[model samples]
Target: MDDDEHLLWQRVLAGDDDAFAAVFDLHASRVHRQARRLVEARADAEDVTAMVFFEAWRRRRSVRIVNGSVIGWLLVTTTNVARNRERSRIRYEGLLRKVRVETVPDHADEVLDSFMRPAVRGRVREAFDGLSTRDQEILALCVLEELAPADVARLLHVPAGTVRMRLSRAKSRLRAALGEDHGRSTLAGLGGTS
Candidate 1:
C-alpha cells in the first residue's frame, strides 16, 4: 500500500471527513472513467460513480484496504453496480411487457384490475423481501431476468445443478410465503420453470 494511502485510510478510520474527501477527490475521476466504460451511459455512469463512493463511505470499516489503495475495490464495485443497473432495467422492461400483453380475452378488466391492486403488489414484493438473500438473488436472476440455469450458475459461481435446485427451492418458499400455488403456469409467466 502507498504510504499516502495508508495515512488517508488511517485518518478516515479516525473519523476525519477531510481525509475521506481527499481520498474521494483523488479517486473520483479514474472511477468515473471506468464506470462509464462499463455502463455505456454518461448519466448512469455518473450515478454509479456516486453510488460507489456512497457505498465506500457506508461500508468503510469492512473495506479491504490493501496496500493503502482502494482502486481495486472501487473497480469491482463499479462492475457490480453496472451489472445490477442493467439487470434491474431488463427486469423492469420484461415485467412491463408482460403486463401489456398478458390478459384474459373475455375477462381483461378483471385480470388487469387484480394485478393493479396495491395490496396484491405489496404482497408479492413482501414475499420476495422475506426470502434469504441467496434465494432472492437466484430468483431475481432465474425468474425476473429470465436467465438460464447455466448462465445464473456461471454468474454466481455455483454449479448449474445448484442453480436449478436453488431456484426450485426458492419458488417453493415464495409459494408458501404468499400462500399461492405458483406452479408451472406462474413460472411460465416468469419466462421459465425450474
Candidate 2:
C-alpha cells in the first residue's frame, strides 16, 4: 500500500463512495488482467472482477486492511468468486440442456479467442483442479496475488508462520501435480479452479 492508497482506504472505510470508486479506477485494469490469466474465459473473468468489487462494497465496513491495501483482499475474493461463477455456469448449462434450449454462442469468447489462446490456461487449470480447496486459496493469495503471508494469514485466520508452512506444502503438492518442470508460481496462474 502506498500513501495515496492508504488515504483512499481510510476514506473508503468512512463510507465514501467516491473514494472507493477511485480505488476501483486505480486497480480495475490490473484486477481484470490477473483475472483473465486465472480464468479461461473472458466473460467469467469479467464476472469475477465485478463480483469482487461488489463484495468489497458490501463488506466495506468489516474489511481488514493488511499493509494498507484493499486490493489484496479483492484479489483473493476474485479467486473464490470465479469458482462460484464456474459452478453456477455449469449448473445453468445443465438446466438449459434439461429444457432442450439451444446453447448460445459466447460472443465474448469469440472476440477473446482471436487475440489469445487458452491452452496454457487449460493446462494450469487441470493441475489445480486436482488440489484441495484450502490449498487453492493459499496458493492464490500468496503466490498469484503476491500478497505477504502475514496478510494472507490475517485473511485465513491462521498464524503467519503456519501460512508459510502451508504454502510450502501446497507448492510441493502442486509441483507434484503439474510436474517439476512447471514453474512453482505458474501453479497459481490456474486461479481458483478447484
Please give the CA lDDT of all the candidate structures.
0.83, 0.79
In model 1, pairs of residues that clash are 1-67
Predicted structure 1: clash tally = 1
Q: For residues 17-44, write the lDDT of model 2, one tens digit per residue.
A: 9999998998898788878877898987
TM-score of 2: 0.46
Query: What overall lDDT, based on C-alpha atoms, would model 2 receive against the true structure?
Result: 0.79
The TM-score, computed over Cα atoms with residue i paired to residue i, of candidate 1 is: 0.50
In model 1, the Cα lDDT at residue 9 comes to 80
Q: List, in order, the clash count of every candidate structure.
A: 1, 0
Error of 1 at 89 (Å): 0.9
Off by over 4 Å in 1: 101-194
Displacement of residue 156 (Cα, Å) in model 1 is 68
- Candidate 1 residue lDDT tens string, 137-166: 999998888788999999989899999999
- Residue 174, model 2: Cα distance from true site in angstroms: 80
How far is 57's C-alpha from truth in model 2 (Å)? Answer: 1.1
